[model samples]
Target: MSIAASSDAARATRRPVNANGVPIHTTSFIGTNWTNRTAESPPPPEPGSYYPMAFLVEQPPGSVVQSHFHAADQFQVVVAGGGHLGRHAVRPVTVHYTNAHTAYGPITAGEAGLHYFTLRNGYDPGARYVPQEAAALKAVPGRTPWQTTTAPVEPGPVIEGPARMEEMLEPRADGLGAWRHILPPHAALTGPDPAQGMGQFWVVTGGRLDGMPPLSLIFVNPQDAARTAMAGAEGAECLILQYPRRAADA
Candidate 1:
């Protein structure tokens, strides 16, 4: 098969994407009061593969996100403000990757409060506070405190790179992996690096992603890496998902 044909065939294997980023106005789910703007929704054509979705999460000044857990794994990019991940001091652009049922938070917002973009991959049964007995907890017992296979929580920033690209964190069995990509204004991905052939969802965190908006993200099959285009005047940075794209049975 020709390279382009082969690439198109590969891209066709993944889920369908309804272009145009969705807005996530406001939500007060969990125990804390916060807001969000969604960029992607559940994959429409798949049943068990990683169905990644991206959204913005915000907490007001002086507020706190009580300790909690979720049914699916997640990545949080502190896109603005500063805060505490339990005890660690976290500022804008600090990244946090947490596995299912991995307890974390009691996150108190800093003077400027907190704002983040949460990219979730897998089944989202919703958020549940720590302590299985909490009434605010939403996950069922079986999936509530789901079998944790990675550390409860991870926090930090993407490593600086001369190429403006870097693998921020590697995933464990239960953890999700993340990579940061920085592009100068009007520049774009030359092509998907062969090393990044599994699959990825680019979450636009800084500046603007021409075809998409800030807080938006798009998934690309490794084989069809050339299908992506990044263009904007102020340059851009994105948090890319590094999780496997196969079905649970595969």
Candidate 2:
């Protein structure tokens, strides 16, 4: 489904819980694939099927997520607070990508805590912690296990500049890419065709999207037409994330 989710509207779905004695809040934005999901509960999707998942996670100060990897490719965008993903420090608007089976992170929240949105084009049962599940980890023939990080974008004029797009993760032949757009009030920007990638997620990081406030999320399916983001009166800043072609697509 090609639809938009307003940040305010998603607030109703917020569920607070404790993970290993740490307080955390998970808010669903695009799909219900996350609710009550566990490592063995949600059955895997049919081969070659497409599933999109998007949500925001808030971790209290000093919270930590042990090093792990998922069975599906995903992107983690740090939208607020401060933290360290392994050795690299992260703050607002930092984008991190990891192909399936690529292990990374022991994410530790700083004094301010950590808030990030996780986006995925495929369903992953849950994280597989290292060493323990290490025996289950096997490399896929053609799926390159890779990782990338984009520099953070500060507030204000940094996002109020002339309407233009900045490459975050350079576009690849496999359709893996990311871009940030800075648009003046009411300005319009069309995204890359979804046919070229697994799917696309339009995230409003600054200002508004069709009048929706920041944190708004729009998911465009591969079969749908390219989405055009219309800035709200206050202007806008957005992140366009495209998933790479999966083996099933071949």
Candidate 3:
């Protein structure tokens, strides 16, 4: 398991890119530097093993991210501002999941701009854009173009009570699931077993978790024992994101 506070994350912007003649506008808050994009010469991706990646992308208002797909499954949580992720309007607390190689998006930031965190359990070279990379996409073995969006919820102040749990994405046979938990001040709550899925990411969307403020993140591996989340004085509201069963396990 790994725990990190967003405030301590490394921040950077890619060298100006305008291959398509459209400026790529983004600032990254990197929580794990498995492959440092900010390095003068970023290292090549390691092969044969998993390296988790978690980072936040901040887009200025009106900026657009072209439709693309990645080589690994990922969960993107919109943490603030508003946008249309493809055709779906996305706002804070909205969860979006896409299976590996499943193309999606053309994310357009709203007037307030958009902020989202990208969480993945394995390494991916980078985004493969549509139309331009359309042939490359067709060359790869197809996985189901599986994707889903959860309704957005406004984070509220914590209440006094035993922690409350809500299923934002219904658990499926393949073990993909998403949950939101609200913990009262200083209360401790054991999360769902990580062994039940490929991996899990606990995100502090509101209040605090073990003294870490909002945007704090925890990544739990499948072999890790179920971990407990203890709320800080202001309480905590967290979103749990789990990946589906890996092919080997299935």
Candidate 4:
């Protein structure tokens, strides 16, 4: 399908409520034809299934994200910055920039703390941030807490190049399928893309993504399951969160 046709399809399938019950909005790009996903939602979990959510976080110098854990596995892609992990005396470590799938954080350490992002797998139900007791973990002064990172899994060999789109079979064992896409400037993908199966959420990272004409975010319900489009101008890279098909339909 042409980029326009694909965007129209995406809009037709856009889900209204994110996992957290937040209302989602889809807008078009100003100069070019494109769509962007915006908003935040709580993580959803179902027995045997997994859900994927993406965020574009910005931490000021020395800021810190208190340690936290989750029932399901979590992954993070560091787009920028250098930081340390662990409690007490933070361990010096550099985040992975090239590889998006690399897992970090949720490590177990003695008395000393384990510094890292990305929730650990098989911990508890729902997304879990650090508890109040451990809130002391702070990003060292002069450095911002880990921020401006992309968690989209690297695209597969079949789909390569500037449009670095990756499809990963979320290892939830619950029959849940989740994937992330990182599109470069002027790059776009058509549906029925995976984002359609699970309602999608997007965050802009860098460069403006023009959402106009055929390029847009679409939502389609089962009744018609087609014919809807929402476009927006994404000034740079954006993040996307997609809920499971069952949850989205719910």
Q: Pick the candidate with the highest lDDT.
A: 2
lDDT of 1 by residue, 181-234 (tens): 777777766434423334455666666665555555565544453445565776
Better of 1 and 4 by TM-score: 1
Q: In each prediction, how many residue pairs overlap at the backbone (N, C-alpha, C within less than 3 A)?
A: 2, 0, 0, 54
Question: Each candidate: RMSD to true structure?
Answer: 10.1, 2.8, 2.9, 14.0
lDDT of 3 at 175: 81
The alpha-carbon lDDT assigned to residue 145 of candidate 2 equals: 68
Lowest lDDT 10-residue stretch of candidate 1: 1-10
**What TM-score does structure 1 among the candidates reach?**
0.61
**Model 1 steric clash pairs:** 24-37, 24-38
Q: Mind giving the per-residue lDDT tens digits that candidate 4 earns over 38-139?
A: 344233344223333222222333544444533333333333333443422222222211111122243223233222222122222333345542333242
Off by over 4 Å in 2: 34-49, 139-143, 158-161
Model 2 whole-model lDDT (C-alpha atoms): 0.83
Which residue pairs in model 2 clash with each other? none
Better of 1 and 2 by TM-score: 2
lDDT (Cα, 0-100) at 151 in candidate 1: 25
Per-residue lDDT of model 3, residues 1-250, tens digit only? 5555454454443323442334544334433343345566456465213556777766778888889988878999999899999899999999999988889998889999888888887777677789889888778764667899888988877699678889999998788999999988898978888889888888889888877778878888888899886888988999999888867765
